[model samples]
Target: MNRSHELQLLSLEMQNELFRILDFWSKKAIDSEFGGFVGRINAAGEVVPKASKGAVLNTRLLWTFSATYRKTSNELYRTMADRAYDYLLDYFWDKEDGGLFWECDYQGKPINTRKQAYGQGFGVYAFSEYFLATGNKESLAYARELFALLEEKYRDPEFEGYIEALSADWQLMEDMRLSPKDANSPKSMNTHLHILEPYTNLYRAWPNEKLKERILVLIKLFQKRIIDPKTGHFNLFFDRNWTVQSEIVSYGHDIEGAWLLHEAALETDETEVIQSVRQSALKLVEVTSNEGTDTDGSVWYEKEGDQIDKDRHWWVQAEAMVGLMDAWEITNDDWYFQGLQKAWEYIRANLLDTQNGEWFWSVDDQGNPNAKEDKVGFWKCPYHNSRALIELISRINKLKI
Candidate 1:
């Protein structure tokens, strides 16, 4: 055996980045006024006191810190996770509706009470991880409640999919876009992909039969609808009847879903499902690498047909490292390992803020960092990069070095 010298060196970088990412969030994101976490931090490293908080950011904070604590048993991580949990329940939870509000004012009052299925999925994901770390019954109950609520309210019977969002009380909403850039469609690969991620995490703590079934269904759904067979990329937006509504190819989601789908299948007892997922997962990796990544090793943001978005976004690079590493583990291919090395190098050279603690949101075509984007905000939570580092570190430790 070569003793995994290559992986050992890479693991050192990942461990360092993991701590930096967590430390930055802990020190800067805590809100003294609002109870949960701060709503946003501008690009200049200044916190926006009056910025509204989001369920997505808070729940992702809960998940990231809880996951870090579970693996390391660090008291500081536990305290941070506790803070996220306390704030999440205190402000974000809709007691009457049994789901989380989409957004809240700086004073912790609900401003947008719509129940986005995506938000509820993170609720299950975060609460389940917290329960795993602490064995807290209340957290477990919340996780299960969110899981059930998602099934009851979001699951589409006719399409065997999920609707995007509903009113606070679960009534159908006319506008179903997850974000302004997103198409107003009932079903989306992004939503379904994220829902599958949380459900997979929740199954780790509960492992109920229904949860397993849903996980299996979600995996098959990816194969049948979410992933376009010809391109091996995700179909971004979709309608109620499982029709793909947009032609956008989200490289981050494609690569992330590659490994995630495989992870979901592994949690189940179905042999056929695991085998099917294996092939689909590998195809996703291959296609994304071929079309979605640059020669310098960073993944692109998105592409449609032959038109590509050349800018490198923070989350895209974070996911690319993990996705390539996961592909290496699946096939034991040095090619994927090489890709991972390139991604890490690119991130270090471009996205990482050497003077600051966290990473830059993105670098443009000329390799200049995008300064207008929020350093920490509703969409810029610590989940992607932190999770990527954690995943890489954990996987490296498992190798027979």
Candidate 2:
């Protein structure tokens, strides 16, 4: 097939997959009994009632549906977005404190009340998308409020980058890690990348000098602190003074942040920043394609020293497709386009659950889906793969070919 035909065919598949994803969430993921979406659906496609709801999952649900609604004006998507928005306000919002509570019980009672910067960033991301889709002044106000909360509580003035986690009342915490797997560092590339993502969306909804300035600061930080120039990988964890804490390389974040940082700069229209970031973004994509992507075009989970965890994560595949297409867009390189094609084929053949509605959490090196993980849970939300489809379809439509 010619390049234009190739693009057309893939775009059709992506559109189908995107709606399949949304339909799965709409039909199977909703929680009629407990108010918001169900907190946990196991690998067997069974919902676990009474599971604690997470702010990240809820907020991502809000973003996925709102963004789709914005594009298609689908009332079903609008209903899903409204449900997520109402649930967040009724359950997740920290009415007394400034930011969102991390988790809530199945019945909508706050459980893990500590405020996480990552979750807060998703709040900003989701609320901003909600506002942009519906023009709801209250959603925009909430997004702005979350932005101010992140600035006031998380942003470190002396050391620069934002902190990882704070107490329920927004005080410093001893165990500040987002999860047990993460190092207990005061700062993280993941947190900063997420914050940059939402801030970019918020700037689209409502451009303010302070928000744009923060976005610029974050773009620079990634270019300097997060990205290793020698290797084109992100330094995962960092201390309060911006010292690197870990050498672990996550291929997912490397590719995800590559396009995200570029997107941030594009939103700002700062020529110097965008020009600088373009080079880094292409380099990051090239490096990830070289070092981290498998021969089968599946992106690995992480690399520590000489040991590479060979598990093909679902999120990594999603981001790799976008990053590869992004590089192709910039350079018109057939290498990246081929990489995108191979990676999407890999996902279709390996990661997708033919029996279930949504994609599997991961497939091992031997190409077997790990059946132990949750299908939909705190970590497994609709954002990554859905966003990839959304981005790819939009970009493909704009292609001259």
Model 1 CA deviation exceeding 4 Å by range: 1-3
State the weakest 10-residue window (summed lDDT) of model 2.
Answer: 223-232
Give the distance in Å from residue 20's predicted Cα in candidate 1 to where it truly belongs. Answer: 0.7
Give Cα-based local distance difference scores for all models: 0.90, 0.93
Task: Write one digit per residue (lDDT tens) for candidate 2, span 130-218.
Answer: 99999999999999999999999899999898999999998889998899899999999999999999999999999999999999999
> How many times do residue backbones clash in model 2?
0
Question: In candidate 2, which residue pairs clash?
Answer: none
Candidate 2 lDDT score at position 372: 98
Tens-digit lDDT track for model 1 on 195-262?
99999989989989999989988888889988897878889888799888898898888899988898
Q: How many Å off is the CA of 377 in candidate 1? A: 0.6
